[model samples]
Structure formats: C-alpha cells, structure tokens
Target: MRTKDENMRVLVAEDEEVLAELVATGLRRAGFAVDTVYSGDAALAYLGLHDYDVVVLDRDLPRVHGDEVARRLVADASRTRILMLTASASMEDRVQGLDLGADDYLGKPFEFPELVSRVRALRRRSARPVPPVLERHGLRLDTVRRTAHRDGQELDLSPKEFAVLQILLEADGATVSAEELLERAWDANADPFTGAVRVAMSKLRGKLGEPALIRTVQGVGYAL
Candidate 1:
C-alpha cells in the first residue's frame, strides 16, 4: 500500500520538446514530481529505472513508437497507468489506444488542468489499498485527509516533508535507502548525488521533535 503523496510521480513521454516541457512544468506546478523524455526509447529507459504512478505518452513517438511502448508496458504487467496523447480525436482512435493498454486517452490541444485531473485520477485508481489512517509510535497520519500528528499534536509539514514522513512510517521500522527515498519522494529530475533526502529528513525529524522517531543507519539510510 502506498500513500497518495508517494504516488505523485509522473513520466511525460512526448516527442515534441516544447510540449513535453510545458506539460512537465504544469505537472510540477500542480505538486507532482515529473520527468520528461522526448523519445519513446528514452521513456522506456526511464520506465525501466524508475517506478512512476502514471505515464503521459504521445501516440506518435519516434524510435520504438508509443504503441509499442504501451504494448511492452502492458506485457510486463506494469502497475503504472498509461495515458495516451495524440492529435487524433476520432472515437475509433481513442478506442484503439485504450485497447492497446492505455488506461486513458487524451487528444492534443487538451487543457492542462484536465490532464492533471486525469493523471491524479489514474494514480488513485492504480495505488494499492491502504488504511485511511496510519499510526506508529504515537505518530498518526491520515492518508486521505493528508494530515499528520504526533502524540495528538498536529504537525504543519511541507508536501515533501509529509511525503518523507509517510515513506518512513510505511517502512514499519525498516531502513529506507536514500536512493529509494528519492525515487519515492522526489522524481527523476532530482540529482542522484544531491543531499535532498538528508535535508528532508532533517526537516522531518525537527517536525517530529523530542524522542526522535527517525534513525539513520550510518552508511545505509533512514529508518523509523
């Protein structure tokens, strides 16, 4: 089971660089961790390396083709949802894309807000079921309401901080590596060598306060 915050990762595979950047920027502004690739092959490479909640794929893609990419993803039984994007708006085209394993289809010149909404809806549908509320060590989190409290005291947490806390809590006392945290909390845009995880953990610990709830595994990572 995964939290909504942890499922905010998205991959945008559009051959048009401008459109890809525009979509990625909008998704990021909407609080989604997004990665963009200009080719279907690059999209496949990224998909192989990362766990994304949703993939916004262009139907007409270069190098391997978007339909083939969708087929491979479906054949692999990937949990990641696919949203096919194309200039074609025919009913038959939409049906064909859906039949090819896309969870949803969108015509080009679509509204950015609509894309965001569809992506969010797809992610919610793909996420594994989890308890609405998670509790451990006097810390309680409401996954549905997106709220957290420690010993009955409400904690004002940033989105990233909340995501990190949720991941740590979900680990159930197991150590979560920094790479894993970056994959889950952030997105492919994050630099692998960055200290973003350390900084987020620091803020999370500070918010948790007193009797620290997170423990660092020296060279490994952080644990609850």
Candidate 2:
C-alpha cells in the first residue's frame, strides 16, 4: 500500500549495477518512485530532468563522487534530502559525509527494511514544516519554529521581532502598512510615536545583516 507520502520520488546514484538494482527494486516494492543512475555524472543529469523528494547516493561513485553530489544539491535552490550509502563505517567518513550535506548515512550490508525506514525519514525531512524557510533573495523565516536564518546561519530575534516577522510571512510577499502591523502585531491603544516598530525593524536588520532583504515602502509598513 503506497501511503500518500510513500508515493514520493527518489533518486539512487550508485556505480555497482547489482546494488543499484537491488535498492531500486526494494524501494519500488516499498511504494517509492525511484530512478537509478550508475554514476555521479548521470545522477546530476537525471536531477536536471526530474525533481525527487529524496536521493540515495553511493559514496563510491564514478566521475562525480557522492560527497560532491550531496554538496552541490545542498547548495542548489532545491529541498532534496540525501542519504549516503557506503561500505566504509569509519567515524571520520561518517562525519565528513554528514558535513557534506548527507542527511543520513548507511554503511553497506544493511537490510532492505532499514533502508525503507531511512527513506521515510528523508521524505519527512523534505516535508518538514519550517517557519523561516520562505525568503526572497537572502532572507528566510523558519515558520514552524519561529526562528530566522540568513545565509545558513541562525538569527537571534526578540519576541516582538519574531511576531512582526510572522505577520510579514503570513502576508505572503504583499505589502503591509504600519497601521496594519500596529493593529495586528501590537495594540491600537499603544503609543505609536514611541517608534516601537522602527526600533524592532532596526534590530531585525542588524541581526539579518545588510544589504537588507526586507524593504521599506515609504510611509507604509514593510515588504519581504
């Protein structure tokens, strides 16, 4: 039974024909949409044509190298999760693989059932709710957790700043005015001349670092 989630597509990049076939077959039986490629170069080419929810990559790949592939994918503007598979079980290898952007690592001689579990994890990660994941250019908000990240680093935000960010995110790129923000984020009864919004915006921009991704609309509120 292919659960609604299990229908997610995956890419398998492995040079060994038998092992790649085995993974593809097992994944298909477990209700995943899978495409298998024999080399790193081929994997990149496949990705150019199809978007996958997850990628099962072999560490020992020809031409492209699994670690490089994972790095490139992570740097790209896509949300594809990668699981690295290999025979080397050394700690250094594992850490290096993770540092290169592999979400999960599986040393070879593993069972099919376990691979299914990791695949599920990868899919979940791809669909994971994020509050600050939405951004235009350099600003992103992790919505689910109410955190912010700029250029891959976390941003420290005050409670009020976070609330203001939420309003902008909910607006979905539409311009929001100060009146609306004051009414929605704070109280209409509060002192508007205190420059509360400006203060918060200043701190937020400082944390985010210029050139600012958020824009001022001249006498209005702000736009993301």
Candidate 3:
C-alpha cells in the first residue's frame, strides 16, 4: 500500500473536544504525528515547544483567538503551515484566513480525506521536502508507498520503525540526534527520557540485516 506522507507533526486547535480528537485520530491513522488543544493559548504553547509541520486551527477559538495565533506565528517567522478551520465557509472568511498567512482553510463538517490532502500539500511546501523514494547504499525506502527494501528484498517494519528510518534517510547521512527523531516521529506526550528511539533503532537494524548501515556517533546520535 502507498502512503502519501511521512510522520509530519501536526496540531489540531479546536475548542470542540470531540471534533479535535476525531481529526487527530484520522491524521494519526494517515501517518502523521498529531497533538490536540482546546484553546488558542494551549495551541500557542504547543507551537512554542514543538516544530509542527502544520496547525489545523479553528478560526473561532477560545482564549487567544485563531487569528492572533496565526499572526504571532507569522510574526515570529515560524515555518509551520497553518490550515485554518471554521464553521463559516464564506468567501470572505477564506480570504481573511489567507490574508492572515494561513496556508490553507477548511470549513467545519468537511471530509477527512480533504484535510489529509491539504496537510500533505503543506508539508511539500515546507522548508524541506523529501522525495517519494529514498535510496542510500543498498537500502531503498518508498515513503509514499510505505515500504522499505534492501537489495530488492522487502523488509517488514512497524510504523515507528518506518518513521525513524524515513527521518534518518531524510538526514542524508548526517547524524540525527535521538531527540530530533522523537520530536518528529512521536507526539508531544512522548517522554524524552524514554528509550523509544533506542528500541526502534535496534529493531530497524535487525530488519535491515547484514552489514549494519546505521552508525552510532558515540556521544552524538545515529547516522546512515
């Protein structure tokens, strides 16, 4: 099966807890790392702490207001893309959102698939975008297809393992710290002290097999 996007991090900022959770679940199932907040203040707090690929924001939000959140993010020159959401689908609303620096806008009661499509599109327009397939040495990973192969033999991999591998390949031989891997692959709730990265790396190496391609930089992190 083909996957269209990597584990791009996303934030869902909507006051309606039910809708927010539903959106988060769908995005997570579609292979994106997602976090949710009920207020604009919490949204901004999360934004300050994490480098989200996109924010699925509600225009009419509690506390800080979605417009102010977008304005602040833009003023700070943050690279995170904004996909403004609202109950109103008026032309004026769309234009206002775009004018406020939102990368895209979606009204409420929208289809889940369209939201996924928009998020993927925003990731492509990010500061760094990866190709559908990545190859280094004898290893080949199809990010879009969600498959990995070594010397033409397909390898079985878990979701986390696939995400970690994609991050390493995207690094292009540069040593990626475990912290960076967790931030990109896991949600905000992931504990930094947890050995999640180590566990995932070990399994990934075993699946890759033969001469180990992943290298540890001692005090540093991991590289291809």
Candidate 4:
C-alpha cells in the first residue's frame, strides 16, 4: 500500500557539513525527503519531533555520540531503522555497531547505490505482510486494524504507529530488531533515514500511558 512518493523520508546525522549536505542532496535527488543534522543530539531531538522512514547515523558524532543516539532510538518504541556509517572499516567496529542495534553498518567510502539499495530493502522488510494480530504481556493487537485493547480498554492507533506497537508486543518480551521492524512495517523501497516509525511509537505510548509497557533493552530492540 506504499507508493514511490509515500516512502521518501530520511534523517542524516553526520557532523561534517559537506558530507551531510551531499547525502541530503543525493537522497532528495533519489526521490526521497531528507533531513540532515550535525550531531547526535540534534538527530535525537529531530527524531523525537518528526516521523521518518530511516536514519543515517555517523558513528563518531558530537554531543552524545552516535552509539548513544542509536541506543536511545532502540529504547524508543518506534524502533526506527538505523544505518551506521563510520570511517573505520574494522570488522570489530562493524560487529560492535551491529551489536549496538544499527540495522546496517557501512564503512566510509561505501557505494552510494549500495546504501540506497539497503534502504529499500529495510523498508520492504518493515512494510511486508505479516501476522498483524498478536498477544504478549497481556496486550492484544489487530495491527492492520490499528485497534488495541489491553484489559478491555480501547487503545486507538494510527497505521504506522500501531506497527511499532505490534512489533513490541509480538516480540513476546524478546528483543526485536529495528531492521526487522523496518522490513515488517514498510515496503522494500523505503528510505533508511525515515523517522516515521519513531514518531508513530511516541504517539502510541501517549495513547497507552503509564508504567511504559515497552521497555528498552539497552543496545538491543524493544521488548514487551
């Protein structure tokens, strides 16, 4: 149910102005809506306020560090897809970033086309058709319907918003990856920096209220 135009939202968290601008322009030219920030703090604030499809993050960011930002995002129920780009190509660094909950880890000097393709792949995984209704932690979800009721209270939800919640509840209290959410909630032609998933989850949390049923697993995904 996603059109080409409907899937273009990207967030770039790179400290270098030239690199950030280049990425932003390239994304725009590729038929995507893009936002670029110079630091991890700015990126996190932007994520809190806006909805995007994917996030392009730099590993070495100022004002909170890219790794910390990634952690915060994972803690967020929205579970946005993150692509960590680092100048370091060390296998250890790659493994660490993946362990830090980034959906994709690309070393510097990566091909632009590969990044774009990865973005699309992440999107497809999120939006694909999967079992919508699921139960966990005493919550019931009818994902496509966007209606949730835990203990008989009618919990209203928007489409993208509920998708985030579904991912958490269906997690069965296990850590669910951000990349997995991207693939399951959107189309393969999705932008990796889009923050829509995060925005949706924020609204969902507001609707649910109290005790925060969703818990953050540090560098891991959300659990019920």
Clashes of each: 0, 9, 1, 27
Give me the candidate number with maximum lDDT.
Answer: 3
Give the TM-scores of the predictions, in the order they appear.
0.83, 0.55, 0.91, 0.55
lDDT of 2 by residue, 175-221 (tens): 77776665444422347888877887778777778787679999777
TM-score of 2: 0.55
Rate residue 43 of model 1 by lDDT. 92
Tens digits of per-residue lDDT, candidate 4, 146-165, equal 47887678886655566567
The residue-by-residue lDDT of candidate 1 on 72-168, one tens digit each, is 9999999899999999999999999999999999998999889988997898777765566889999999865778999999999877887788778
- Give the 10-residue window scoring lowest on summed lDDT in candidate 4: 1-10
Q: lDDT score of model 3?
A: 0.88
Supply candidate 1's per-residue lDDT for 113.
81
User: 3 or 4: which has the higher TM-score?
Assistant: 3
Q: Which tens-of-lDDT digit does each residue in 1-224 have in candidate 3?
A: 11223468899999999999999999888778899999999999999988888999999998999999999999999888999999999999999999999999998889999999998898888655688889998889997778999999999988778888888887878888887788789998888888989988999999999899999999889999
Ranking of all candidate structures by their TM-score, best first:
3, 1, 4, 2
User: lDDT per model, in order?
Assistant: 0.87, 0.74, 0.88, 0.72
Give lDDT for model 2. Answer: 0.74
RMSD (CA, angstroms), candidate 1: 3.1
Name the 10 consecutive residues with the lowest summed lDDT in model 1. Answer: 1-10
